[model samples]
Target: MTANTHDRGAPAAPARRSGLGVALFLEATERFSFYGMLSILLVYLLDVRGLAAPRANLFVGSFNALALVSTLLGSRLGGVVLGPARTVLYGCAIQFMALVLLGLSVMWPVLFLPAAAAVAVTNGLTRTNMAVLILRHAGGGRSADGLATLYTFAVNLGAMFSFLLVPWIGRRHGYALAFGACAAGLFMGAAAALLNRRALAGGASGGTARAVPRAVAETGLAIVSYWVVLNFPAGGHWIFWLVTSAIPVFWAWAWRNATPAERPGIAICLILVAEAMFYGMFDEQTTSTFVLYALHDLNRQFSVAGVTLFELDAPQIVAINAGLTMLLGPVFVVLYRLVDARFGTVALSVKYVCGSVFIVIGFLVLCLDTAGGAPGLRAPWGMFGAYAALSVAGLIMNGLGLSVVTTYLPARMRTMSVAVYYISTGLAMYGGSVLANAMGIGRLHAATPIPESLSTFHALFRGFTLLAACGAGGIVLLLPVLRRLERRAG
Candidate 1:
């Protein structure tokens, strides 16, 4: 079948478009709720729960990593047992309950870890399946690229609102209110999914009985591994290493199983996932290290005529990145279409390389800010530049990464490939956590002088800039191979 042809069991064009709209709504809501909670989680843990910076960073990082890694199990269950549509509904219901528990944890305190775990696990089921729904609704065609861009726009739009609103609510009312708002968003998503059930029909059927036992076993192992790493932060890097090391083995298995025509596409997918790990490492700092920096160093107050109007909270500062992404997304989408119209489809490798360079530039901007001898009141323009660059990098890297999975992989592999892509990010988040800790920013207390921490932050930024530069150079070296693979796949 051609790329433009509808999948075997897809609905008619009009129905499919309707389904796509519903899926996008669900995606936006889910992201809004999930990211809203995350944007405030570090502060909640530190201020409300009375945890130190190191521990709070670990908790946030582990939560993100576990949520992503568990997608392996979610993919198996969604693709083989429950089907994507059913899995999405179930995930929404579970996520709602998890958010409620998180709200309650503000009072009880003991419920915090378990509530976080619930949110993480349920995320595995929802994130990948929602993307699968979008792909199915797109009829798995060339339009998938445009739809993927729209999908990313929806994600950032929801995140932008949540990042701005949730943090404001948390700052004014309480963290519990923020959590409650997230739960409300999830409830809306669930309602939409239920109301549009017929339009979202026809996903994978339950697999053979023999496959069930192994799926259950793999899920059990994945959960146990996450538990151990979460409990033992010192050894978490090893766990992430173990998880990431399996990528090659999984790729080899997929390549061997695939037909000759499919191998090139599979190869491209693997390369993109690997490249994305570096991007994820840098990008995730917005929620962790960057938030801390803004809280301690950035001058977030707005003043006119020597009168302060409002001051931005740390989490709200993080929202600037999402807000910028929302603003920039449409411009990039139009630019990509124009390029594709004049020239044929752009190679995924080229986009990946461009994103890497942007990441390097973003981190360099941060590095320069750190070196500028600003004590506790660094200028916000440096952060603005960094956020803008990172937003563009994400629009290119993450947006196109999802498009590659949906466009190239077969139906049977699509969900699993999506899951693997997420796993790469999981590893990156964990890696970023380690890097954050090494910078010693976690050791800074409320009374600690900002100048004392400047060198450490500067060093960290310079290291990341170097790392991203090396990654971009490596991709450039492999461009010949990547282009060959694209041609073979075509």
Candidate 2:
């Protein structure tokens, strides 16, 4: 659960909640499907398609951005066209189709991009709906705690499955079979929802079939328009510029619409958004470039807390990060409580700052250990530390994003502000793709390894460290001002 939910104190009235098991099940399954697809994507692109590393990174970024941005459109339509429950059902079906295309890319090399777009739209449709469904039945009080508990558990559960199952299959079997397994997982989720249709009932009133076709069309059009931009020179840069320009505009409109009291929170949101672009650069890499590095370079013999585990392939070892997060989750909870008792309430800005710190440390760990050469069989533990640190960064940032807007931003501006944040993520994803290209990730790949190209990859890691340091430093420099703003906003 997020720090906000954790710190909510005891329930005003204790009561049991049910009917959310189906939503949580869907949540777990959706993440499993999404991350599972991604776990093998970069390696698949490199080894199977013979695409250059930068090109593959751009491919993932462009399509992933579409999916993240589509959630906005999905939220509006999911409530009506099919209702949240049915919308999720439809989305799972769509995702299954996408995965089928992805799984079979060996035969049809041309379908990957289109398949990616479908995946994004599917996530956009279902991601928010799961949480909304949970909230609908949560009512309030301890049931709300139930919501937090379920949300956290379900997310990690899905990631755990993705990291453990999907990549292992891809490493041991083949990409096609691995993707087929993900498809099967999605189908099982759909089947579960169908069998327990009673538990899945009672979402937004289902709208006409016409409504869904239009919604899907509009969303598809958005993706097409976004994809069309790939033709532009300096496409990633211009896209980043254009997307970020919307942030202040959003906050400006929101600020004017909000009460005088809400302005400070909006101000804080803008700061968080700015700093978050850097966070995106690293966070997105955990999926793309990092996984690729592991595949080509890092040692895959795995262990945790001195217990040796199996000698998994690099892609398979990515699951270990998910496992590590599960192990550390409780440690963080207890640490948060202790810190709260010892130092008083931790400010949201502080959380972001600290998150940035952890992230930078993670990057530095990797950069320092890999300074002189390609990572091949060198600095094995550093990547593991990097993964662990990044996982913590993920939790802190997730908490900040999930709770900050609702807890701080005025209710009137919450939705739009949240949209601004997510839209920035799309921009940042593009920016990250740009950086991946910039950082010489293009030089590192499978099927060929230039020993001298180690310099290029090392520069890339240093760039990551520098980007994270600068972003976090900016947040730190302005830390006092943001804290005051938070107090005033509250």
Q: Report the lDDT tens digits of candidate 2 across residue range 116-226.
A: 667877777777666556554434432332344446557777888787888778877888899988888888878988886556655335677777778677767755665
Top-TM-score candidate index: 1
What is the per-residue lDDT of model 1 for residues 1-490, given as tens digits with 9 covering 90 to 100?
A: 1235546666767787777888888888999999999989999988997877778887788788889987887887788787777777777786788799889988897676666776787788888888888867554443666777788888888899999899999989988899999999878877987898766654345455665567546544654555556666666677677887887888888888898888788888887787888789988787888888887778887565777777778888877888888888778778877887899777778988899889999999999999967557786778878998999899888887677787677666777888988888888987888787876756766665778667667877888888888888998898999888777877
Q: Model 2 — TM-score against the truth?
A: 0.85
Deviation of model 2 at 107, angstroms: 2.2
Clashes of each: 0, 1
The TM-scores of all predictions, comma-separated, are 0.92, 0.85
Scanning candidate 1 in windows of ten residues, the lowest lDDT window is: 1-10
